[model samples]
Target: MRPKIYLFGDSITEMSFEHGGWGASLVNHFNRTVDVVLRGYSGYNTRWGLKVLDKVFAGSSESESVLAVTVFFGANDASVEDRCSAFQHVPIEEYKQNLHSIVSFLKGRWPTTEVILISPPPIDEPTRLLCPFTENKSGLPERTNEAAGNYAKACLAVAAECGVSAIDLWTRMQQIPGWQTACLSDGLHLTQTGNKIVFEEVVEALKKKGFSLETLPVDLPVIFDIDPNDPLKSFQGI
Candidate 1:
């Protein structure tokens, strides 16, 4: 069975297969080496994510092991409680607990699977206000950079406590001058540049945890090495 890497999160993850998306980048990077399983639910927070964890993971068997799992959420969870999108709001304390629970649950099911937590990217309030999705809506830009930063710190804390890796996108994105205009498209979703940043950070984090495609055996034979009349020979060992 092929090794698997699961990307679990909210809309950020769900939309990651789009052209130039971070998830797509990973898919291409690990092509033919591992299966990239996307379990993203648009607009979901950690609380909602935990409710469906079992359905998504379904525990790995001895024959099929999960190589890594990236738990990326918080964008929706950071929604202001009194805002228009309050339905997706999760309390700060609960957010932290939920992240811990997610890590613990996944670890229990697949002890060897690497867990990488990704905090929500920074939000651009002005751009969000101008976005058609939020332009005429009340309580516009329901999320703030500060609120997202808090969640990002919480996510990092959870990773440290669980001995896993984390990508603090909230903090990292802001470090880039004028990231507000260059990274996110609607203050919430990522643009191509934002996706590229995420893809690079995720790759670096995975490498630090010893996940390297260079060491992983390809799932199929190189096309050039396969004989047209004797294809089985190239796949003999596999």
Candidate 2:
């Protein structure tokens, strides 16, 4: 049977566009072999994600099996309001703590579940430079993306510490040729082309991990191994 993968994030993830987000594209690319769940919520931070885990953790079971989970947060958490203008810049310390809580809670709930931490893509120059509110934020160019990159790396460090896996979207996203145009629009979120590229990359990574698109079913359902009333239940398969 194909493995199930769940995606968790905010607006960048909430909309898949005509080509669908990476998650949806993953499903389509695999042609119903791997089950993909899109639990993207707009304007939500990691704080809000924890509160809404129930809907995101719906698929996975001992019988069906859950392969992995990809987490994309820190966008909203990074939002900052400077001189009457709002930006997406979460404090480094608060972001770290939030991630810790998120990872700890998930690891506690599903010990065997695989977790992946994805950093947000780079910010667009025009938006960051032109936006009157966010232009003066501490991390204008390098710092903004750096914080997110660091956050992802932190997750990688934690994953390594905890013996899990991590995907460096920030690093990889930067490497793509014409990436500035291929992967982002308005400094955030994937354009249709961007989502496709991400999906293809994810598929490649999954293949490297031994997951075959030929094995999963397109419309597979999620499985819950624990009781619904559990506090950690919200994070199962997350």
Candidate 3:
């Protein structure tokens, strides 16, 4: 079977296959070399993600070739505890523990599979108000950039504890000028350029691990290698 890279996260991940999305671009980058699977749950926090962890990997085989699995929760978990969106909030400490548990589970289930942790992007409180993706009758932003940064930091800590790779998207985007407007669409989700950033980062992570479009073997011969005179012969030993 083809090796797989699983993307697990919230809405940002759930919608990552949309046009100009990072997941779609990742597929294009990998071409036929690997399979990229999406297991994103919109509006979910680490708590909910932990609850469904078993079901997500229920049918997996111990020996199956899973190249990597990315844990990218925390946006909802970062919701302010006193806000209308608090229903989805998981305490920062609990969030860390849950993320740790997730990485442990994936490592235990597939010892060779690389685990990557992606921090939640920062919130644009002002734009979130105008966009109104959530039910916010409180007349205040349900999430804040500072809160999101804490979660992002927690995610990085967990990655360090687990000795795995991580992408600090929260901090990375903020480093660039106008990133608040340039990267996000609804102050939480990604724009096309934002998706490009993620795709490039994920690619860099994989490349760091000695895996890349050029390094990983393609699943089958390229069309150029197919012999019209004896097409079936090329597939005999595959």
The residue pairs in collision within model 3 are none
**Any runs in candidate 3 off by more than 4 Å, and if so which?**
226-233
Give all candidate RMSDs, comma-separated. 2.4, 10.5, 1.6
Better of 2 and 3 by TM-score: 3
| TM-score versus the correct structure, for each prediction | 0.91, 0.71, 0.94
Model 1 C-alpha lDDT versus the unseen true structure: 0.87
Candidate 2, residues 1-238, lDDT tens digits: the string is 6666777777777785345667667767765566677777886777677777755664444455667677778766655434222444556566666666677766666666567666666666555544433345454432255545666666566556655556667777788787766787656678777787667666766666666656544443334544556746655475
Candidate 1 C-alpha lDDT tens digits along 78-100 = 98887767888999999999999
* Worst 10 contiguous positions by lDDT, candidate 3: 129-138
- Which of 1 and 3 is the better model by lDDT? 3
Cα deviation of 72 in candidate 2 (Å)?
A: 1.0
C-alpha lDDT of all candidate models, in order? 0.87, 0.64, 0.90
| TM-score: model 1 vs. ground truth | 0.91
lDDT of 3 at 39: 92
Cα distance off (Å), candidate 3, residue 121:
0.6
